[model samples]
Structures are given as C-alpha cells and as structure tokens.
Target: MYKNLTITSLLGALTIILGAFGAHALKKQLSVEAMQSFETAVRYQMYHVLVLLVINLYDGFSEKMKRTLTLLFTAGILFFSGSIYLINLFGVSAKSIWFITPLGGLLFIMGWSLLFYKFLKISLQK
Candidate 1:
C-alpha cells in the first residue's frame, strides 16, 4: 500500500531530478559514454518505480508478496542504478564491480517473475 506508494512517489521525483541533472549539469562534466550509462540508470530506476506503483494498485497480492516485491524492486534500483551512478559520477571503473550490475538485473528479473506468477495464479483461479 500506502507505504509503497509513498516510496514510489519519492523515487519517481528523484528520478526526474536526477534525469534533469544528468541532462544539464553532467552533460559537460562526464564523458559521452558515462553520460549514456548514467541515463540508463535513471531510465531503469524510473521504469521500476512505475512498476512498483502499478503493483501497489493491484490488490490481488498478499501483503507478504507485496512486501517481497517492494524489497526486490528497491534493492534492484539501489544496486543497479546506484552502482552505475557511482561509476559515472565517482569515476569507479566498471571492471572492478562488474558483478553487481548483473546481480541487480537478476533481482529485477526475479521481481517480474514473481509478479507474473501471481497474475497467472489469479487468472487460473477465475
């Protein structure tokens, strides 16, 4: 619920702010590749935020499932988007932490999988 909605709203707002900052402020400061990476992070973060909002609106899930989805999505955003932000903004080499991005991607995949399972279960029950 409301907690998820509130967090998603904040995430959405931050995504917008970060996107604008990347476009205007970091455009000149970062390399073209770094800027692109940063933009990717912002895009994924926003996408998941929207997904979280949609999940919140869907009432078919149990509280535990909702919580699990929230946690997974939140962690995915942190690890995936946060790592890219750190690399581009702080000049951390991607090679040093190549593993983190994929782990985050895995979490994102798991979150979607759980959502799909729930939807299928609900549909089959009808």
Candidate 2:
C-alpha cells in the first residue's frame, strides 16, 4: 500500500504540474483541439489517480488486487494521458495511436471493478 501510495502520489503531482504547463506554456503553441484533448486527458488521469488513492486506503485489498489496481492505474496514466501529451506536442498526423485512450479507459474501468468485487466479498463475509 505504501508503495502504491507513493507512486500514485508522485504521478498525481506530475499530472498537476504537466496540466499547468500545458495550460500556460504550451497553450500558445498547440492547436485548440489538441490543447482541449490534452486537458481532457489530464482531467481523467487526475480523477483516476484519486480513485486509486482511495482504493489503496482500504485496508482489505488483497495482494493480487493491489497489484492489479496498480497496473491498471499505471496503464491508464501512460496511455490516456501520454497520448494526449504526445498529440499536443507533435502533430496528430504523425502518430496513428489514438486507440490507446480507450484501452486506458478500460483499465480504469477494470480498476473500479476490482474494487467493487473486493467490497462485495467483504459484504458477503460479514
């Protein structure tokens, strides 16, 4: 849990810094559409980072669940946000990689599903 917390906290901080930089530093250079996409990615990344933090807060997460959630969160951060950052920094025509965003979204959904399953198991045991 500590490891997950530490990493997610760092990732969250990075997201905030990058979001600010994107808003102020890159806004002038990027196309409006690219900038919007970048902002959207940052928004979703930050939201999921918080959700991961909450999942870690739960003391009952098994080791498997922890590992799965961590992987999912990492994938979401990399693919979803990373794609947007790249799209803004480079021309969209250069890269044909927009499909990664949905994969990242699926990871985020899986993370939530894992959490729900854990909750259900606990409720049943009680």
What does each candidate score in C-alpha RMSD?
1.0, 1.8
Question: Which residue pairs collide, candidate 1?
Answer: none
Residue-level lDDT for 119 in candidate 1: 90
lDDT of 2 by residue, 21-109 (tens): 99899889878887788889899889988887887787788767877888888898888788777767766642588588777778788
- Stretches off by above 4 angstroms in model 1 are none
lDDT of the candidates, in the order given:
0.91, 0.82
Task: Give the best candidate by lDDT.
Answer: 1
Summed backbone clashes in each candidate are 0, 0
Best by TM-score: 1
- Model 1 vs truth, CA RMSD: 1.0
Off by over 4 Å in 2: 92-95
